[model samples]
Target: MPAAHAATPIVIRDIRLEGLQRIEASTLFSYLPVKRGDTFDDDKASEIIRKLYATGFFNDVKVSTEGDVLVVQVAERAAIGSIDFAGIHEFDKDALTKALNSVGLSPGRYYDKALIDKSEQELKRQYLTRGYYAAEVTTTISPLDRNRVGILFSVTEGPSAKIRQVNFIGNHVFSDGTLRDEMQESTPNWFSWYTKNDLYTKDKLTGDLENVRNYYLNRGYLEFNIESTQVQLSPDKKDMYLTLTVHEGQPYTISGIRLAGNLLDREAELNGLVKIKAGDRFSAEKLQATTKAIVDKLGEYGYAFATVNAVPQIDQEHHKVDLTLNVDPSRRVYVRRVNIEGNTKTRDEVVRREMRQLESSWFDSNRLSLSKDRINRLGYFTNVDITTVPVEGTQDQVDIDVKLEEKPTGTLSLGLGYGSGEGPIISAGISQDNVFGSGTSLALNVNTSTTYRTLTVTQVDPYFTIDGIKRITDVYYRTTEPLYYSSTTDTSFRIISMGVDTKFGIPFSEADMVYFGLGLEQDRLDIDSTTPQSYKDYVADFGRVSNEVPLTLGWSRDNRDSVLIPSRGYYLNTSAKYGTPITGTTFYKMDAQAQYYYSFARGFILGLNFQGGYGNGLDGKPFPIFENYYAGGIGSVRGYESGSLGPRDTSTGDPIGGSKMIVGNIEMTFPLPGTGYDRTLRVFSFMDGGNVWGTEGESTGANGLRYSYGLGLEWISPIGPLKISYALPLIRHANDKYQKFQFQIGTSF
Candidate 1:
């Protein structure tokens, strides 16, 4: 209202709205405080203007009265027409627009300059989190027809800031390098490009600080504290310097361990669960573990809501701490129901059969844990979560809810690999781990290379019987070409074999299974001048073709935490096969493998594997040459050609696989740089040693084991699992064939 209008009171006959383009007259009247035949004053005019402006429909408003007729004029804010981005390589434009919408700035909504400024700051903050310290965001606004405006966010994403140096001060016990090694963030290293540990971000810095805290606390520094941290950016904004000041408190040792509270009359047994003892260094990790163990123990006895608290009694003078564990087993509850959710594709019975915990039974944490592991091992779901929900108004009953996030169980894979010896290997496979959600599996695979070609079809019924027995059937055809032959060789030697096998798996325990199978195969050899003498001798001895009826027995146990990226646990498998004399040649072969994995830290894992094989004559019949075992490959000893180890023909220099094989590997894996703790991608350093030996026929001068060490990369890519290794042979022999670089897709070691 103007001063003139404020001084006079008039009776308004009508209220008029001017400068109305898209707004309606009735809409303006609804906001008017005075109607027709009513007295109007400056107060009413001011009230009318405030209400209209509150709607955010108008940018400017003026009120006046001309001879009892109040007139209102306003300029509305322009509605957003379109939002765009330029020079935005760091983020998707659509994502940016959605982000801006969260801050009340997007198309089809009225535009506000203050909100635009806030959006710009948010955009800049996003860049900073990604190490783009020099990033700049500028907004451009242009008018459009129909009271609308177009928004363009022009961004300049500069080079990412790198951590040039990291320093720790006020440290007496540990060196700067040692502390830095414990932190995730660090200065540039050889693997920095992949790990991005050299990049500095506030979140990563916070995590690094926590890591430092845990490191000290785990080493008995009960009073350790970080005084301060400072991050400095270079003038060019391309480099960063990090400094952490810390107080290293005196170390403390455990004086005593006391157990209190309800122990269910099992104090002695509960006390046995304590991992800490007198005179041992005080460790936060051990304290937490002890508490968790107590709680888990209580849970195993139907106490689903158990609590354990450890209170430390400090004796500062003696540098000792006495720990008191307070246990509370809240309630012994029975499961009212076991509800399964998020398994849209899989049948309920499939998951139910795997569960050891049942409805209407006392809650057992051990059974629940086993159920979770069993579900995970199925590989049908990506994530599984089981939580006990207390029943409303009930103290002794709870519902067990199993939540699952399903993943695609079908895979169509195409693989391409190159080896100095194999020469362009290609393979394709299609498989469904959970076919039609029935918990069965079916697969067809074809692999071809210069040395061999194979086609196989397999089917597996995991629940062949209600007792969890498994049945597997396989039909396969394989052809092997002469290994040392050139592509130009017009005449080459080849061997073809076809077989069908059926196996039944009987579960002896949760992690162990025993398998028995029968197979029949016929091998035919086509010989040429380039064939190795061993192959010719075998053909002549077996009359160019041979049939075998083999019986196999196998045992396997797997308790790994994860099949794809195992961090802990062990796996053992052994198989033995004998050709029945009633049908074909009489021979026996056996193979065994043992693998173990241990995780030292969040992203560091150690894996060890050993494999051995043996084949010999039975009932005076020699072991068939076609059934010999070959070594020296990515899965065996790196830096050596695949299937190129062991005995070689004295004439053609071609590898004649041996009847005995041994291989071992020691590997350490860590998260790939820049990938955080994601285990899908990792880097590993490994040492491998293995050799093959002949007992009956041909032999090569290289008789000892070949050892190699190298670094490798493993990635679960869109196509499949990919592995690349750059190995250097440590002990090379005169006849050893070295392959320094090797890579394969759709395979695992």
Candidate 2:
């Protein structure tokens, strides 16, 4: 032990502090046990020294008495000038800095040797949690002038400890492979590098154990329990082994079920929501689901704080369990206010108008969910969250807060590409779905290619009136150079068209809508000797120019869960267009389409689509060739060239489209492997079967159905939706052009 610096017993008139660079004299005095007009003793001096040192702001302390006055001095600790790290590739610098800050060791803070040691230990512990068992951290403090210092934490993060084996013991009812498959962490495999499944984590192990428990519980093992979990690391710390022991009790069957507690006089309705029944095996999952359903039912009746719990009665000898649902319906609550937040760019009214639930109304979970869905369907936000807050003074009044994160709703796209059919193509478009945050849309597009050129402008007002009437207007101009495949030589001709259309949509229900429109169009065909016979005949009958005024009626119903990436629900659309003979060339067109989606599991979806169209001339006039349907290419039949599926001219094998069209598509979409729950990227396998027929000329019936199967990838990139596909045709004609590989960027299908 070192000799005592002083053993003083004296009365201090005033205490003076010295050697403090940043700390104030008053701060030292406040921490000192002995103050002015107090007696100073050895014990007080020792206590004062200990407290000051404990503050972690001082390096040394000295006390002395000078002529009945005490003098206290302290050498303040050096402030950290900078904190840097070396060889830290596993963790980011910012994260390490934050971790050091949590341990009171950061730049601009007073440095202490003890704190540095603590921070190093914490850093090493963090690395261990991340499977970096061989990680080493060495901290260096460099002294500088002006009582400042710099900290350098050098880290050597070795290879992560990979899981070599995972074994489950004492599970008699299930195989070891089955239990291991339920765990997120697994032994090294082909996908281990990407999925990081070979790395062991305590949190992951905990979750895996819970999942194992739930698995047994859901299978009628009412008394299942996990005994212990052991993790063994190799001597080199480069590999790990995990073993889990579980006790799965005998399976039990359900003997009876009963409902108790407050039912709000809706016993029959609540009972109908119970999915579990007598004579079935006892299932924890079913019981929990039934409880949730009962609670949701109560919520529909304004019982916002409802609770339902399933209490089980076990018969040990009989191996049977009886369940009783206990329900408690707290006081019904009413919404006092609805608050919208986090929408910096969008106007409040834009979101508020989509909400179905109103303030001052009884709380309804269904309406609240619908409101959230409607806002999500607008496609203006990335995330939407709704939370209920109880009122401070009232028990039956609550406030709803709708929080949202806005996303970009305006798109500016430019595309340039070359294809065999279209030659060199250049396209550009600018669209705004939420124009000026008014919930209106405007778009303008221009496309130029060797075979076709077009310019279009469109505008839509979703809420043109207070009654939810939608209005859409469109104007377009197009020119096409038909390049028909000729047996001897290539032939071509030119056609120009311009048109304008306006439509009004009336909402009949939340999901159904009816639309009526009128359009005026004119077409002029330039005939040449090289032109195909189909085009020449049409020009000779209808002249070089033809005019038409068309009336259109359409009805659509959309109940999809999401408009951008729907996984459930269905959509249907039907429309008819009739060209008035009194105005110009007479023709009529009818089209009907339906799409359905089914979600089989998390991140798995099945989609089915069907479309049919019929077109013919009125008053015995032949239907205009331009008014025919062309099916093929990326959006139609994937394995064939664009517009190459229908009837072909005998002399020049150019496709003439068709008056009747039918197409059906079935697709299964799943998340990309190793991508977890990321919905932005997906992979899908599809089967497409469809064909176009022409009643105006030659008829190709059921035999014309072209079937194709392929796998495709869809990515929601920053610019737009992109699709890449590789397909093979199952049924094809000899002359049908095959395009096995196709892709489209900056477009949606």
Candidate 3:
């Protein structure tokens, strides 16, 4: 704007402001450089215009002098009244709004055309990442009252582009199929809809390229190179094809590996950590493992910042390479502080008590790793991480930070189930693994069925003593009516049992615990005319009611990676109980179970379980029939009726009980066809073999080992874990009762 006094400068007596709406005149005056009683000229007028425009509050600014008084006129920009999205199914509206807000396009902010265009581009980019190659974004601005505007982002997201094929030009040692297997992206397949492997994404392609490079490098292709990659989109923009050009150079062998660094006078121990030796095929994985092992070894000795580098010496003509592991122990640091984070509900002491590395102690990576594993085993947290951060201005000091993500530690369950042999069963349980954030546990469970009923209450204190011993107390009452015989006769016969026990667990190692307990138990037998002869004889010999004091000893070890969906590790549990003749019959019983899980490939796990039990009476007395072990059920052997594989009553032909039992299962679990690598839902194939044998009962036709093979589905549902299986019994005996289908909830095999 031209000043009225353009020829010369003028002395302003006052300043006048215009176009004030949402913004006040005082606010504008604070930003103005030309104030009241100040000299004004053409240069000052130009400066005033620039200053007002730079504030972003005004869309237009005009500065002029009226009779030596400066006049500043402005047209303020419209504030955003509202922001809306249309046809946004792929993204949440709030999420898109947040994204736009990141780029200065939200309600209450001055609307800018440049920011609108920028936000449109950003939205398009977001859709493109999700394979929406034909997505279009447009912005519309509508004037509202009070000089405000509403923005509408209209998105047209077309069909996603699918990967048609992935081709490799020059891979000699491996076929195109093998190379494609190494990449996550692939042509449409049966499982493509779920895994989205057929979706063409730039980030996934980049990662696939890196994986291909590593595949060749790890297989002794020292000079492997990806010459180029071409991603072609079809004319319709609905299909994508990727072609990678590669040069797989000749494979090289490792000539030798030597350690050359400060090994802390433990050269021999460090050398043993090297997995690759002389005359071996070159492998990048082994080299990386070797370096990490050396670094970890030094970390165990308080070298928290240790470094190990594998410097390779390549020979082209000889096709050989030599590796030199250079280790650097930078500094020996001690932990200055141990910081715990993200334990919102759990007490700090509950977590701190699990740490193996204490404050003001030497940093030991081994101890830190063990601490993480222990916390995970607590089953109270969903995620746990431990990291070491160097303390500022300290050469030999560091801080250990423990980060945790807590999960729901309480479970309230109500289950309704039906067993072919046992009839309708109802169960309910309420348990808390971390009660009151004190690392204590309490649980109550009740189950009732036509043939059996039980109630149990348990409490545990994990830190009963300062020495890491655990105390457990349990009280239970149970009643059972042998299903097989109950159906054969109209008479009623039942066994009632009640017990109270207390145990102490002492940790022998990181993975092992030993338990000792003593308990008082009472058992009563109610029999009628049609009662099984075995039970009648037992009562005749030992009386109808018995009370005893029992002593129990047990050992357990668990190191599974995940308790919910374990992919690797082993678990073992063994227990023995001896009934003393304090008031009744004396007997001995032992049970052992061992489980092993191995993950051989991605999303595939192999599990093996073995169980055995043996019981006998002491002092030449017969073992109590009520105390006999029963097998052939969901947890024992599938495809057979519960407790139906044991010796039977000689006359009634009903399975009575057994003094010895053995069971084994081999199962392979993999991802469900459409679930990808989700562990929550899976399918498994299993072979089960088991039986129950009695040493003194009448031999029935179902007394031998039974075998079955089956397929099962496992789902971690909202209520609990559910397992359903359909089995075909093998070598069926004429008298053996078979149940081809079985299912259970809130249990794991």
Candidate 4:
């Protein structure tokens, strides 16, 4: 717009003032679009006036031009002085503010009568949503100090509506029992105490109707539809009626199935993998499976670039369907980089350590699946999704990116527990999942629990060498107050141990590994009273008496998909603890554990765990007490206290000697909270057979094989896991056994 001039040929012949009851012309014209010496048109001038009026500051605006001199006038609406509420007890101030603003009625702003007129309607709408059908609302505006206006809205919220009747208008074929099962509003059930259906919510009703539609559609009701729903409120405004209309379409069956492209000679094999079959119910899920199976089968043949599609040919007249699967095989691709993403704390080496499919490895679906499972078993990530990102300039080379969300992989725990024989127990531990920015794991533990005291620390470095060999080390100080079950008296007998171990791994196969380690151990013993004479004689006669050092060697093979839920694989770990007692005795200890898991048809997870430990004099001095084996607990042999359930001295009736303990537990895990996809809450029935006792000249007896049958519950929680189990002893071995129930943190599994 041009600037104002002394003689701009502008003049005002007449002035038409609008409803200007308060605002001045100068204040109003300051925001006007048109000024002196500016050309104006009706559309332009009207738009300017409309813009000002839309601000809610003015009720009307008027502009007149005489001889090119313009005159503008306006009437400003009163600003809201304050807001007051009454008869509204349930809703607080925040709720009122949101409710009022829905219709544009708010304080500290100009009052627009049109918005105020809609405020009552909006308030009543809010009440209806909350099941208050008969609620009434009124609004009044009053002048306040400083030319401001106050808004007072009076409301009677009335009573919350209760469901009187809920009926489905049009649902057939499926029985009321079946349909009602999908509804959240259960008429009456034994579990009503847990989930009360008496309370009616529109959201729940709508969701039920949606479920009804899905049920029909998934059962080949392609034309299934929900017609309408009506929610009726009673005159007293305390009762509700919900009526639903649904159309269940004709059911269809799979009439035929066909596969196309890139199929190997194992067409029958591919067909078997396809879950969809002729005469089966026409299900979208089955059709999707057919496509995925074709793609996956081709993947096994190195056809990574395979496309599978399931096209449905619907036979409406015959109420049947046919599935057509088409597969296209492109050039086989290989992984350029098996990379990890979204790991802020975990190191690349840690993730890489678990991958079966390495960088530059062929994209074998089997290997990729195995690798994905390996990474998941690390327990670092809550979820791990492997997707192929195409590489530029090469159709046969792709990058495998693992997208993941890390859970609490490491734990810092403090626990207090007790048993009938042992008093109170306390333990503390710290562990790092991704140590040194690599995928190594390390843990340090200290405990003064039961009759044992330990200060132990261990660490694993998966890629200690540039070529991917792993290393592990452990150093510890452990002491035990020894006892003999057969001895007439128990004495305070203890041995101290300090050891360091290191191991290296060899890649046996893509899915297999073998490892070896060298260890150095030292031991000493202090006997406050006469121990078993046999034990003292062996230590004194053989050079294996207290005080000596020994060298050790070991081997292991691990091939489990998940330590928690292994579908197929065997894990074997064994180590030899050999040496003469550092100061008091000479002894050698050996321990080994072998476990296997297999998942069969359905959700059955079969697990077999075998563990055994023993100490020997090795033609030298007797094995030290600290080097002896003691078990009988949840972690070793359940049904007895730690260090209990062993051979006792004949005179004192106290367990004595560094002997052996054997354990084997076979369990089958079943689903709990059963139908959901998530196994966050699960229950399993298991049979545990194990016992602990002293070894006699490399011989293990029946006394160390007591058995138990039990069931367990597991809950995966944010803080940690919660596990509860009850076991009944199938074989009663002794009288000092504990009650068969056990409850512990979830992560222990």
Across 1-749, the per-residue lDDT of candidate 2 in tens digits comes to: 11124455667788777898877777877888877788877777777788888887887888777877788878898999999999998888999888888888877888778889999998998898778999999989899777899999999998899999998889888998878767888887765666677788999899989888988988899889999889999999999999988889899999999899988888999999988898888888888899888887787778888888778889989999988888999889999999999999889998998998899999987788889988987889999999888999898998999999999999998987654445577989999999988889999999988778999999999889988899999999999865542223455577889999999999998899999999888888876797768778778877888788889999999988866788999999999998875444798999999999999976899999998999998788777787778777777888887777887766667776788899898999998765544578889999998888886335332246999999999988665577788899999677888889887654334
**Per-residue lDDT of candidate 3, residues 555-633 (tens digit):** 9999888778889999999999999866668999999999999999878999999999999989988777878877776
**Candidate 1 residue lDDT tens string, 259-363:** 999999999989999998999999999889989988888988999999998888999898899999888999899999999999999999999999999998999
- For residues 1-749, what per-residue lDDT tens digits would candidate 4 score against the true structure? 12123333343443344556556767666667655555655554576677777666766666555555555556567788788888987678679788787676777678777778787788777676655777888887788765678888898777767566667766778776667656665443443343445346667777888777767766788767879888777778787777777777789988988877766566778878888778988776566666777777677666777888777788889988887787676778888987788888777767776777777867777777877887876778899999877799987898989898987767898877553334456778999877655677889999774466898888887668777776878888877665522234555555666667666776656545566666666555556447665555545654332444455656677787655546578888877766644455455677898888887834567778888887766555445455566655555455554445566555444555346667787777665531322356567777766655664543222264666777887766554566667777777754344547666553332
Error of 3 at 347 (Å): 3.2
Whose lDDT is greatest here? Answer: 3
Clashing pairs in 1: 194-673, 195-673, 195-674
> Relative to the true structure, how large is the alpha-carbon lDDT of every model?
0.86, 0.84, 0.87, 0.67
Candidate 3 TM-score over all chains jointly:
0.85
TM-score of 4: 0.65
Clashes (candidate 1): 3
Clashing pairs in 2: none
Q: In candidate 1, what residue range of length 10 has the lowest lDDT sum?
A: 482-491
